[model samples]
Target chain A: MIAAMTNANPNIRLDKRDLILTKGSEVMLRRGYHGTGVQEIVQAAGIPKGSFYHYFASKEDFAVHALEFLYAPRLQRYAQALGDRSLSPCQRILTFYGELLNHFRRQERPQYHCFIGSLSFEMAEPSQPIGLQVESILQRSVDILAQCLTEAREAGELNAATDCVELAEFIANAWEGTLMRMKAGANAAPLSVFLHQLERLLTPSP
Target chain B: MIAAMTNANPNIRLDKRDLILTKGSEVMLRRGYHGTGVQEIVQAAGIPKGSFYHYFASKEDFAVHALEFLYAPRLQRYAQALGDRSLSPCQRILTFYGELLNHFRRQERPQYHCFIGSLSFEMAEPSQPIGLQVESILQRSVDILAQCLTEAREAGELNAATDCVELAEFIANAWEGTLMRMKAGANAAPLSVFLHQLERLLTPSP
Candidate 1:
């Protein structure tokens, strides 16, 4: 995504902005907002402190843009995963979460839960605008799933009475919680349970 | 609980430690671990800076104890709620979550999701001991729910095929995720969806 963005926009200014956001997101996600400092972000980005100020007025402002930068690709992925036509809509939704759980299992150390979920948890400092942006990203994710669920029901894969929108919201929220547990490290594999329960949820009982 | 603790312990030293934890947990939950400072916690607890150090070796140590203080009451409440015989085992499990959702709805602002969930998300700093402690607390919570689920299945409330342990884990993870969404503020009420889905999962469809 970064390469494509720079290729599409030859502007040095936009390229530098993207560089800072990409590097800034990495640092922020690892260290969290307060744990990170302005100097740390600039150092990580290899940008001058002046350049950082030029792009973002404040750390909070940087976070908003960084979140926007982080979410764009993630939301795109969610749409891609759920909207994949090769799999039936039910499989697409189920497989999407299943694959994510696999990715979590492969991690060497406990990685952060979904960055956006962590950010929302850490965002107790009360930035209204940032809160609004996070809310929008969360909705977009749920909507992407909702679309696939709508397809599943239309295809007779799901029961006719299922509320696609509500199911989408529940799945999205549950998936976030699953990610939360993935980091906390439970005695039993939450994803296996999540996938098992999800299969039960999507498939009718005999 | 605090009242009971104080009544049981007449030691002045223990009383001071309890006061610090009570006040410290309140601040930590509201402001978060990194957001809060030792001095601020001292002020909140009305103890001297020297006294704060007397109780805890470091901020991280303070957080661990605070988490313990925080979880004790919460786990107690969970055990009490799930063990209440006035409700059937199925209703005990389902209604515990439903009531929690209603409580979330009553919140004036986006209160933090369960503190443990938030800390696990925020705990990206690689505190192995803290991580293990959180994991154990999570398991204890799951076990409490699992015991209730086992009873439900034994009482013929849930399907015979139900895996109570797995279901308990999934519900705990999903509920944590549901709380994550609760703070994010989605278009739909997650708790209602969570409750709706929980009902379906617990009660077999004819």
Candidate 2:
């Protein structure tokens, strides 16, 4: 059936897949993993219901791919910012978070949240496959941030005595917490405060 | 029908209600709002499907009450801790979080998360009644924390220049984020780090 459908719309197969993934990411981000249905995703993507099954095997399968779709570009951007040698390692970290806060600010919704943080809370159960996927993605992000912090410590841009790994974990966790609160409070004030405090906390005093 | 069902088990009315709410809170915390079914909640509670409907009108109604059921006692406990005059205001703040961290440490499941945080992420849409309930409960907690910070500031335990409201918001958000990370990482390290960092962040310079 999938082959038949793909054959019928060969030119649009790739585009349709992208469309589904993009729409899935948006709906899942807003409604959460359990709240969104495949039908809703198809409707939002403006594709036939049969097209959904053609592209993805199951909702869980779709969710895993949707998460990948959502995070891939963001991860690339994160790497670009963190790996920018033109900026000091510490400045790279700060600039990365600053850009994130700006992105959150530009969102039209009063309640802004992180897709990974939200999904992690909603689906990070031992019994759930998506939970494990979320855990891996989160760990990967923390690892990247830890690398940046280690570089900062080596460059004397951060406190030499600080545990960069632990600090990185704290930063990642704190920022995720800040996003959760931002959504709860229905404002960006928490994001702003987190950014300001994070910069101060990471900066060593003279 | 609900009234008849309640009258049928008049003496156990309150007990059964508590049972359902407790089980509902647990399932909702683990599975999320839309992810959990009414049947699952009833099964977990060992109550009949009829009993669930007898106690609550609908899933959203049940959720609102379940949130109240979960937060009310915690709020009282929080007040008791924060209002402990024997402890310095700063000590009270630290003690509350310390106990919370210990509680998180005691959970058997690696993916244990906050009920309020999970619900807020899953159901905190402006259009949803449950969202409003969650927002109100969260705001109340922040208000309580803010009050504690206010006391600390007045006692010179915290910096006078710090905005207690904003700091309280940050603390709440950061802690929520930390819980999300803790679940994702399957450990209590984030909770410990959050506590340590929060204390340091809030403490006035010598």
Candidate 3:
């Protein structure tokens, strides 16, 4: 049925696949990996079950793709913010977080903002394919932050003694935690608090 | 069916209920709230299907109770660590995290250590009772930390200018984020990094 449908209308098939991935990302982000079912994704996408299989072999495979779909644009934004040479490295780092704060605030549900963090907690166990994907995405994010910190240190924006790699990982870890609190309390106070404290840590002593 | 089973042996029914809750907590912690099924819990506990409803009204209700069950013991541990008068308040605070780090290390799968953090990301949406329960539990945890920080301030263990309430929330938020990283990396590095950063934050400048 899937082959016949795809052969009849390849363009429609591609559109349906994109639709499933988009909707799947939304539901999975909200409900989590194990919590979401393939049937629900199909229903939400308004596509047939067979189409889901045609687009992806399994739910986990679909999740991997869905994550890539969710992350690709955000990664671009990160590069844009962190890669800008005009701003001081420190400003770039803070600006990235400031923009992220605004992004979180703009969310109808701020708690659902970081799907990667959500899935990391929900699926980063038993060290399966899904877990490895989450680990790699997080590592890449941390690497970007580490690069920014390294530049900041070189420019004398940060303490010369500071360990950029460790600090970057620490910041990322704290940010993820702050996101969890934001979701649990249904408030943005934690994010603001994190920003305040993080600035204090990053600033040079008077 | 539930009423008949309960009437048959009330004591045995109570035991069965406890069994179901215990097993449910384990599976839910590993799989997440929506990912876990009633049948899986029942099967894990070696109980029949009718007994599940006999104990709890719905999956949401079961989850709320399961959270309570998981949290009660941990809360007691926190209280004990935070309430110890023999140590300076700073030592007490550090001791709590030290103990937590050890606990995470002891976990065969450390990613599953913080069930509240996982559930916060998974179920802390406005759609259900589970979210409220998670929110309240997290708040209570934060409150305890705030109280400890307040004591630390009085003891001159923390900076005089520190806002204990906000710092408490930040520490708690950062700790949860650290746990998420620990899970994703499947290692103890995040916990160690959190302890290092948290200690630095709490210490007075030389």
Highest-scoring model, TM-score: 1
Q: Per-residue alpha-carbon lDDT of model 3 for A1-206, expressed as tens digits?
A: 56547586777766787799999888887777787899989988988899899889999899878878788787778877898999999899888788778887886766555677767777767537777888777788888889988999899888898888888888888888787777777777788888888887788644
Cand. 1 TM to true fold: 0.90
Model 1: colliding residue pairs: A177-B177
Candidate 2 per-residue C-alpha lDDT over B4-84 given as tens digits, one digit per residue, 9 for 90 to 100: 465866657877888899888888776677778899899999988998998899888998898898888988888889999
Q: On a 0 to 100 scale, what is the lDDT of residue B58 in model 3?
A: 85
In model 2, what are the clashing residue pairs, if there are any? A177-B177
Better of 2 and 3 by DockQ: 3
TM-scores, all models, native as reference: 0.90, 0.81, 0.87
Per-candidate clashes, comma-separated: 1, 1, 1
Top-down TM-score ranking: 1, 3, 2
Q: Considering DockQ, which of the candidate structures 1 and 3 is the better prediction for this target?
A: 3
| Tens-digit lDDT track of model 3 for B17-88 | 778888888888778777788888888888888988878998888888888888988888898888999998
lDDT of 1 by residue, B113-170 (tens): 3568657777734676566778888889999999999999898998788888998988
Ten contiguous residues minimizing lDDT sum, candidate 3 chain B:
B1-10
